[model samples]
Each structure stands twice: as C-alpha cells, then as structure tokens.
Target: MSASARVIRSAEFQAERAWGALPVAELDGVTVRLHWTDSPYIWHVNDGEEVFVVLDGQVCMKVREQGVEQVHWLQPGDIFHAREGCEHVAHPQGVARVLVVEREGSV
Candidate 1:
C-alpha cells in the first residue's frame, strides 16, 4: 500500500460551505472522515462499529435504547463509540467538526 503524509487543519475545515464530510483515509475497508455540521443528522443504525471523535465545538449525541431515548453531551476531545445495530443521532450545538471512523459504505 502506498501512503503519504499530510496535514489537516480541522478547525478550518469545511465542505462546500455546507454541512457535509471530507474523506480522509481508508484502511482495510474502514474509512476515516472529517465532518462539519451545524445541524442534526438522521437517526440510523450502523451496519458496523463506529468511532466518533469530537474535534472542535460541541455536540449532543442521542441514542435509542430499548425504545427509550438518551442524550449525552460531547465536547472537544470527547469520543463516542457505537456498536453495530446501535441506533443513534448527533446534533451539533453549532458549527462542529468531527472525526469519524467506520466500515466503508456503512450508514
């Protein structure tokens, strides 16, 4: 596999001036992405495990467990891990940047 070094200023990252993502890297069918958003994402369950890291700003993570919804506050440097089949959604307090790692094509 070929690899090169690069630098990403996460704080200054944006995609089309909208809430979206930028592909970072991939390894063994897993994908790493940098996402910027000021809105909430749809609630869905991942087909595989997911690792979400708050890179900048704040977010409120919501998970549905046993039909009960739970909410957790996330700040910069906080990490949230979602196992396969875990239903969850993320709501950004403002414009927030996040690093997400998961199986490619998973949603």
Candidate 2:
C-alpha cells in the first residue's frame, strides 16, 4: 500500500462472483468494505450500526421492523442505514457492488 493519502476507485475494487467482501480501510471502531453480490444474504442483525451504500447495480433490502418485514429497492447512489439490532438481508438483482461501513467484526 502507498504511504501517501489517496482516493479509492469504488468501481474498480476487487470482486469476483456471488458475494465477496474486500476490506478497504479501517477507522476507529469502524471498517469500510466493498462488497459484490449476485444473491441474497441470510437474515442477520448487526452487532452495531451499519451504513450500506449502493455503488452499482440494484439491491432489494429486506428489513424487519416491529414484527413486519419491509422491502426497500436500492439503486446506485442509494444509501441504507441499519441500526444495531435491525434484522435485515440484502438481495442483489444481479451483479452489484456496495460499500459498507460498520463496526469492526460486526455481522
């Protein structure tokens, strides 16, 4: 890695097929990761807050709230924030890239 400050080319980040997560950087109690997915992830709750940003393609975010399930369709540039204890899952329509910011080691 270069020692100088730089920019991250979100579109060019490393990703193969299905779902993949590549760590970009880590901040105090936070981790930034680039994710690529073509399928839905299992329902889960984060240990802490999560900021999910769609960089490319589309995603359907399934969130459970007050005993009800809500679906949110996300496009490029859309951002979805999930607070801790918010059960949710992400379903990518096809090949999609997302930037996620959350507590380190959270799931």
Candidate 3:
C-alpha cells in the first residue's frame, strides 16, 4: 500500500443512518472505511494490531478467541484498540463511519 492517506483518520462524511458497511480498502495495515450504516465485520487474527476509530457513526463489536468472546458498544468519536491474535465481530448501532488501522504484529 502507498503512504499517502486519502481519508484522514478523524474525518466524517454524509450524515445518514446506514444499516451496513461497504469496505473501501487497506492502507498501511489499516482498513479504509466507506460505509453508511453499521454492520458486523469479522476479524480473524494471527498476530495483528488494529485501530478502529469512528469518524462518523458508532460501532458494536464482538471479539472471540478459543473459548472467549465479548461484545462492545462504540459511539461516534470512539476508538477501539485491538491487539494481535484477536478474533472479533463488529457491528455499529447507527449510521457509522470508522477508520480501521491494522498492523502485522501483536500489540
């Protein structure tokens, strides 16, 4: 991936209540979000650190590994930090826009 950033980390766009998220692409280990609504996105990890920051809407997330899984409620202006090897499912409750940055290593 290139080093130039297209969408800034904290930028929001088009205020609307969306029900699902459409993926944009990956940038420097982070996933560029371009969705209108909130949907559950899964992360199957094998040592990768990720940063999930809401630029417009909130995100509901669930992480599962081995025999453990947990849920979360994320609002706009909220950031979720994830370490490596964490499997998760994320779904926001409203029209949510988020910037997901992940690195190939354990945090």
Candidate 4:
C-alpha cells in the first residue's frame, strides 16, 4: 500500500494564475485537482461523476436538468456533485479556489 500527503496553499496557487488547474493526486480511478478560476467554464458533460468543492470564494454552478438550466450558488466549503452525463458549467464569482475529484481524464 502507498499513501501520500501534501500541504497546499490555496491562496498562493490562486494568485499564480487567473484560471488554471494543478494536479494534486491520483489513486485508483480518481484524480484530484486544485483549480483557480475567475471566469466561467464552457458547458460540458463528464464521462463520469465529478465532485466539485469550493475551498475559497464563491461559484455559480449552471446545470442542464430536464431540458432546463439551473443555477446553484456555492460558497466556501460547499460541494456540488455532477453525475455522469450531467451537462454543467462553472462560473466563479471572483477568485475561487476549487478542489475537483473525478475520474482521470473524464473532462
């Protein structure tokens, strides 16, 4: 068995880029990434489920459900789960640090 640990400074990471993702870990079939964004991402569907966690700032998660678009506001510590085939896009309110967990290369 192998285990690893890391200390991430979210603020530092966010300050480095306006919008970007940093790979943190990969185990089994899941990959963990740290994202810093101040813009909206294009709508897309994940090949598998995705766990989006807000570590800092806010996010407006837009999802297409039942042929309608729904907006979910997320704050720090909030989480939004997107099941497979769920079309969604993320809009950051400002400088937001997000932790994303999903199947490797699902996006």
- TM-score per candidate: 0.93, 0.89, 0.59, 0.89
Error of 2 at 16 (Å): 3.6
Candidate 2 — which residues are off by over 4 angstroms? none
Expressed as tens digits, the lDDT of each residue in 49-96 for candidate 4 is: 999999999999999988999999999999999999999999999789
Ranking by lDDT: 1, 2, 4, 3
lDDT tens digits by residue: candidate 1, 16-74: 75358889999999999999998889999999999999999899999999999999999
TM-score of 2: 0.89
**Mind giving the per-residue lDDT tens digits that candidate 2 earns over 26-99?**
99989998998878889999999999999999999999988899999999999999998999999999888999
Q: Which of candidates 1 and 4 is the stronger one according to lDDT?
A: 1
Residue-level lDDT of model 3, residues 1-107, one tens digit each, is 46754544434454345433345665565555545554555566636677877767667788886778788888777888777667776777755677665543322
- Provide the lowest-lDDT 10-residue window in model 1: 1-10
lDDT of 1: 0.92
Q: What count of clashes does model 4 give?
A: 0
Clashing pairs in 1: none
Better of 1 and 4 by TM-score: 1
Query: Model 3 misses residue 80 by how many Å?
Result: 0.9
State the C-alpha lDDT per candidate: 0.92, 0.90, 0.62, 0.90
